[model samples]
Target chain A: MISFLQIDLPALLVGTLAALVCALIGNFLMLTRQSMLGDAMGHVVLPGIVIAFMIAASTATWVMLTGAFAAALFASLLVEFLRRSAGVEPSAALGAVFTAMFALGVLLLEQSGVARTSFDVHHILFGNIETAIWPAATGLSSLFDANALANLPPQVARLGFGLFIVALIVILLFKELRVVSFDPVFARTIGISPRLIGAIVVALAALAAVVSLSATGVILLVAMMVCPPATARMLTDDLKTQVLLSLAFALASGLLGYAIAVLLPLGLGYEISLGAAGTIAVVAGVFQLIAMIAGPKRGSPRNA
Target chain B: MTEFREILAVLLLQAGYNTTVVMLGAAALGAATGTVGVFAMLRRRALVADAVAHATLPGVALGFITAVALGFSGKSLPFLLAGSALTAVLSALCIQWIVTHTRLNEDTAIASVLATFFALGVVLLTVIQTLKTGGQAGLDVYLLGATAGMLRSEAITLAAFSFIAAAVVAAFFKELTLVSFDTEYARAHGFPVRVLDLLVLALVLAVIVIGLRVVGLVLIVALLIIPPAAARFWTNHASRMTIVSAIIGAASAYGGAALSAVRPDTPTGPVIVLLAFAILLVSVCFGSARGLVIRALGTQKLPRRVS
Candidate 1:
């Protein structure tokens, strides 16, 4: 029993932190209906990392993160410019800008073979989260050892720090985010800058994405950002309840999904585990699907 | 003497018979995607095709594995494509289910399914790649696509499929336009709005399937979206838009194939998409209908959002 606890506890920690950070920012995104922003960032982050590598001349972690954020900003502005000046629809504009940029990134990677050597597109998509959770904590006792905790894998530390920053922002300015999400006009009337607040939310989203990518992978980050909040939204109308419920759902999905990914292969008499990030997405999607059918919130229309 | 011959061969597409077949096949695929993609864009559901494209990944991996299990050449295009078509339709149905059954917005619905299905594909592909046979080589082509390897029979199949799809759209032009413009009005006029909607969806799926073996899934959405969007800059009439889109699609595919042929190892999907985008840029700036430059020079009023 003790051995099982030791094995599962660290995974539970890493999954919770990754899920928490994504969900906190995701709730506001759901209310604002800017989920496409998440999609846009996910694609653009690739080229950002590449260009950053070229300039930094080193594959330092901060350089890649900075490059990713800058690329995302540039891509977002380019999308807007295409829409405003070129008269493209919002979706089409995003599709045009990012696919071109993504393809460009691919070609650049091929030119240098950097994608194969460093980026590992497969690793970015499915992630190495299952073992990340386990290997970070060598044992349950180390959880209480300050020096041991300090020596944890960078993924665990980075995700934990990301959650801290996200939580601080949410708590410090909860009401402003709520108002901006619900009604920007009302927010502006009350001396708040909805646009500014929205920008901050997007910035937080990008930061969360940077931290979450290695743990949850790139495509799975979309699920992490959208699924729990979407489920919470389906379950409640109150913003506060949505936030709290989103946190709870994220915890459940992360732990449950991680556990399933780890144990399922063993059950099948094989040693190979499935990708944790994808399994988590599947679990979250399934939860949302079930909630759509059974939740008491207004997911379904009544027969009038 | 060798250098001159190499240049001449590439210029004439004497690069190989295989190259010629692939080039023409790509053009047909391009034309079909652009024409159908316009209606999808008109309905403002342009990104639904993205979901469909990503969703086909699992079907592809499964189809290959299942074929190998049954003692057939797992790399057979037809069987793999059949699997993809089934799964893409299933994912589409799931999207429809979510839209009707949940309060989630359409973008959210597309994003959810795209992410989920794609993740599943990643898991399956990862597993397949570890197998000692077949897995190490074939399906990676579906990721970025390698057009040179396309068989003559496959090229013929793609060309034939594109012609049939374009013909069906041409035949149903009137009904499709009416429903696309005003669904309730079309229904009141006794046109089957739902069936027309399904037809539009099926057309998009067909473009996705035919485009996959060459263009791959991730970039397949570009083929569906970019051509029609570019064509919209040149005209307001539906038939004219369709024509222009087809031409643009054909031209881009031709251009991309030629480029890929010249450069022996370049991936074809991105080249085609980028070419389509280049035409769009030209169209947006200078096409006659409501081109930005033309409007700026006082030929007509500038376009607003939906124009």
Candidate 2:
């Protein structure tokens, strides 16, 4: 039998970091009812990534990440404009803008064939976590060593750095995030600009999505951003507990999903790579379903 | 003049039979989605169709596998559509269940369902890809649409479904509008609110089934959402909104399909969505009732509110 750690340590770390990044922002998103924006950003990030590739004429990780950030900022700005300036409903605006952007991305991908250089449409839609692995003799402590770090898949290292940045932002802006999430008007009265904070949070979510998308794909990223926190909320009323519970659930889902994807093929002796990110999404759904049915409190729309 | 006539003729009836059938199917699918979409928009479930669309993927894969196992051609359109219809209805109910039972907002519920269903689909598609038969080639069309593979029989089936959906909506128009605008009042007035609500869900699901052929799953909801939303800019009257939405839907469907026919590389579904998006943008800027330009200039007549 294949050793568990041998095949999946790097994949697990990547998933764990993705879950952590998503859970950090996902908590506030659930609190503020802005979870769906993550979904929209996930959809529209494709065009940004493709555009970045085209302009850079390379598929460097930084180029893709920057492209995704700009795209998220642009999409969120468009949504804000449509809602604030025009009279369009918020959900409709998000649906319209993201779908249009996603379709445009697909068209561009077809026309330019540039996406094939660095992006796989299949991998982008569902993700390819199996490819995240440590090279021979690479160890966690050795990640800092130049030879080992160079051997690391750049996406994994980027996710690690992303998690540190997100953790720092959350730590530094915890109170601001709480106030803005709970009551923007109250935040404004207390001398805080809710718009700036909200923008930062959205930017953070978009950036997290860029980092996570490589491992979890777009739809699964949406699932992670909403389901874990939403499920945690079903089990607790305390904000801190909700955040912690969400992080725990996110990590559990990533690990469990990876286990299922790896074991099923080996057990059945099948020649197939069941999508890892999708399995993680399914596992997260299972967690939410269990929470909704048997959590500490009965869920009601009023609480939301 | 003769050359222009010849070109026009070639573009229309003289085109390949598959093109004509697919175009007709596209038009019907568009009109039906637009008509049903008005109700979805009125009820503020603009993104619920997205959930329904994604939820159908697993069903399509399962349907293919089941058909093959049962000694039928796995590519049977009817079987695949049935599978989609079944899953779509079930998942729509699940979303409703989450919304009515949980503290999560409808958006969260929708996002969860959409993602979860798509996840299940990805798993099933992998299985389908590993099948012994070679019938999985066109199945991915349900992802981005395989308009070139559309045939006369499938188009006929789709058109019939659209007509049936339209008739059902027409039959329940009064009750639907009543419930849409004022659910509590409709309940107070003895409307079977739950029944009517499920009926609308069923109608949306039916249109989505036909839509899978034209636009596939990824962008199918746009067909339901964009045209009706654009129509809302022009009129507040629900009936008039439905009519305008259907017209916009048909126009975009026919026009987009024609353009795709000419441009060999352009997929029919995305082109259709982009066209609808363009129309919505135009409606936002210049529509008579709430056009931004009219509002900016302050020269247009006040929007006539039905209430």
lDDT of all the models against the reference? 0.79, 0.81
Error of 1 at B261 (Å): 4.1
The DockQ score of candidate 2 comes to: 0.59
- The prediction achieving the highest TM-score against the true structure is 2
Alpha-carbon TM-score of each model against the true structure:
0.89, 0.91
Model 1 agreement with the true structure over A246-265: per-residue lDDT tens digits: 88888888888878877887
List, residue by residue over B1-307, the lDDT tens digit for candidate 2. 7655643654575777778877777788789989998888777776788888989998998899889999999999878998998888889889989988878777778878888888899888877787778878778778876566577888888888998898888999999999998999999999999898878877888888888977889988888778887887798888998999998998788767776666655677788888899999899889888888878766434444422
Candidate 1, B106: how far from true, in Å? 2.2
lDDT of 2 by residue, A184-218 (tens): 89999999998898778887888888888856567
Candidate 1 lDDT tens digits, B231-302 = 888998889999999999988887777776766567777777778888888898997887888778763444
Candidate 1 segments exceeding 4 Å error: A1-16, A130-151, A298-304, B1-11, B131-133, B182-188, B261-265, B299-307
